[model samples]
Target: MLDIKLIRENSEIVRDSLRKRGDDEKIQMLEELVGKDQQWRQSLDKANALKAERNKIAKQIAEVKKVGGDASEQIKRSAEIPKEIARLDDETIALKTRVDEILMRLPNILHESVPVGADDSANVEVKKWGKPKEFNFELKSHGELAESLGLADFDRATKVAGAGFNYLKGDLALLDLALMNYAINCMVNKGYTLIEPPFMMRRSAYEGVTDLADFENVMYKIEDEDLYLIATSEHPMAAMFMDEIIDEDKLPLKYVGFSTCFRREIGAHGVDTKGLFRMHQFNKVEQFIFCQPEDSWKYHEELQANTEAMFQALGLPYHVVNVCTGDIGNLAAKKYDIEVWFPRQGKYGEVTSCSNCTDYQARRLNIRTGKHGGDKKSVPHTLNNTAIATSRAMVAILENYQNADGTVTVPEVLRQYMGGKEKLGKV
Candidate 1:
């Protein structure tokens, strides 16, 4: 959530940001709601003054009655004040609720560094690594190669759980674990703490971490419970410090979270329905950080650098894009995505995203820091990235490393994780 004070002081700047992002419909409503907020505050001030007057009269009436002096008229009028105050309080609460609703829909102000663009085409390709391999014969997609090697079982998976679900069998299952463990180790070596957090989070906590639209359709809410399955390890990791204060010395806290994340994937009705290109559940080693406002940008770079390092180690072809303003959604002030090459798909697709959400999430989650009543204190900034999401990585590995005869070569970094196997051949 944006700071209410910032909204009040810079309404025009906020409105302009919304307009630039093509969120024109929300501009007028923001203005009207802010006006109501101002009126509500004014009425609250008046109500306080009136309550003080009533209290004074009540005290005077009590003394008058004790002395056997007449106090009936003052007492009768003073009794009406409570009802009026109650009415004002109700109005104040209603207006405050409306104000909060508008604020939730408001997007964060774009970082000056974010490139101005409408969609993916405008995203700046900031980096590239490795080259797509050449094949002596036609390369098969990962889904086909894995099926032949008895490494993945999509047919059985669909029969039991429907599409977008799969079973990683034999070496494939081992590879998934190896990749996540290796990613976490890399993060740990860089001074990050490794953590395995809850796979489920309360809906209220989900709201603090994600956009409102995702709550109803993208999340899998447990019936009769306030909790929902996590869409990413980042969700639980980010929520860890809710309503808590950290010491200033702990600024720039970093952690690597591991989990098998679940997602509804409602928007992907029939797309990539065949393979690991998209899946309902997959293992992930996520990077999450909380830091001082001044350090968030630096950490964003560090996080992206870490992701690129992983891709480089895997020896996969990939490119990095600076997500444009419209493509960033509302959460991030600035975001970057790394798209690993998928040979079968014939183009790059996002395998990882690193974003600097600034104080937007921290404000909502109440993640604050610094010395007790110290000058340097406020809600800390938040950042998260896909250190590695197994599903997409699986797609890249299978399609790019496939042999013409239908064997799949494992990447060198994952060789030990695969028990030193050089290739997975036909079953």
Candidate 2:
């Protein structure tokens, strides 16, 4: 959530950001919020004035009684004042509720560096790493190659759980674990504490981490319960300090989180439905950080560098894009997507997202930082990046490393985790 003070003081900045995002509806919502907020302030002032008047009337009533004069008129007027005050109080509460509702739904302000565009097509490529490998023979899709090598059972997975699911068998299952282990070790070596967050979170806490639209579009809710399966480890890790204040000395709290995420993928369509590229369940290693506001942009680049190094070690060809305003979504002020080369698709697919959310999540979660036992406090900035989404990484690996002989050469970094096996072949 944006700071209401910022919105009130520099509304044109917010308006310009929404315009860049092409979000006219929210522009109108902002106007509504401003009007309602002004009304709420006015109503509160009236209520406070009435309260002061009532106090004065009470004093007058007591003075009249002390002098042995009739106090009936003063007492009667004081009683009537309370009824008016109560009515104004109710109006003030109602307006506040409306303002807060709109505030919660507003997108975070965009950073000046973000590209102005309508969608992903306008995203600017910032960097490219490694080269896309050339294949002499026709390449098979990751799904087909995995099945031909007896490394996965998509047919059975589909029969049991419908589409958008899969079962890894033999060496392929080991590869998945290897990916997670490799990512965890890489992040840990970089001074990020490893954490395995809860796979589920309550709606209230979830709201603090992501846009509420995810409730219907992305999240999987538990039946008859207030819990929702987390869409990413970032959600739980970010919410860990919700409604709490951290000491300023711990300004930079970094964590590498691991979790099996669940998503509904509602309205998703295309060839990815038949493969691991898009799945309902997947394991991910996430990098999350909480730091002072001034340092967030620096940490954002650092997070991107960490993911780039991992991909380089795994020998995956990829490129980074500075996400455009429209594609950056509601949470992050600015974002970068790491798109890995897929030989079969003849293109790059997003395997990681690095974002600097600034103080958006902190404000929504009510997380703050202050001196130990001190009264002063301010919201800290939050950031998250995908170290590896194992499923997509595996897709990239399978397509890029497939040999003409139907074997998949294991990336050198993952070989140790896969029992020193150099290649994965038919079971």
- Collision count for each candidate, in order: 0, 0
Give a tens-digit lDDT track for model 2, residues 299-361.
Answer: 999999999999999999999999999799999999999999988878887899999999999
Kindly report which residue stretches of model 2 are placed more than 4 angstroms away from their true locations once superposed.
55-75, 266-269
lDDT, residue 311, model 1: 92
TM-score of 1: 0.94
**Total backbone clashes of candidate 2, pairs 3 or more residues apart or in separate chains:** 0
TM-score of each: 0.94, 0.95
lDDT of 1 by residue, 1-427 (tens): 8888987898877887777777767778778778988987998887788889899999999999999999999988898899888888888888888888877877788887778888888899988888887666765667767787888898899999988788898778877887897898899999999999999999778888888998766789889988899999999999999888878787779999999989887345333436777788888999999998899999999999999999999988999999987799888999999999887767898899999999998887888898866777688999999999987887787888777777777889888876788886444
The list of candidate 1 runs beyond 4 A from truth reads 58-74, 269-273, 373-376, 425-427
**Best model per TM-score:** 2
* Highest lDDT against the true fold, candidate: 2
Per-residue error for 308 in candidate 2, Å, reads: 0.3
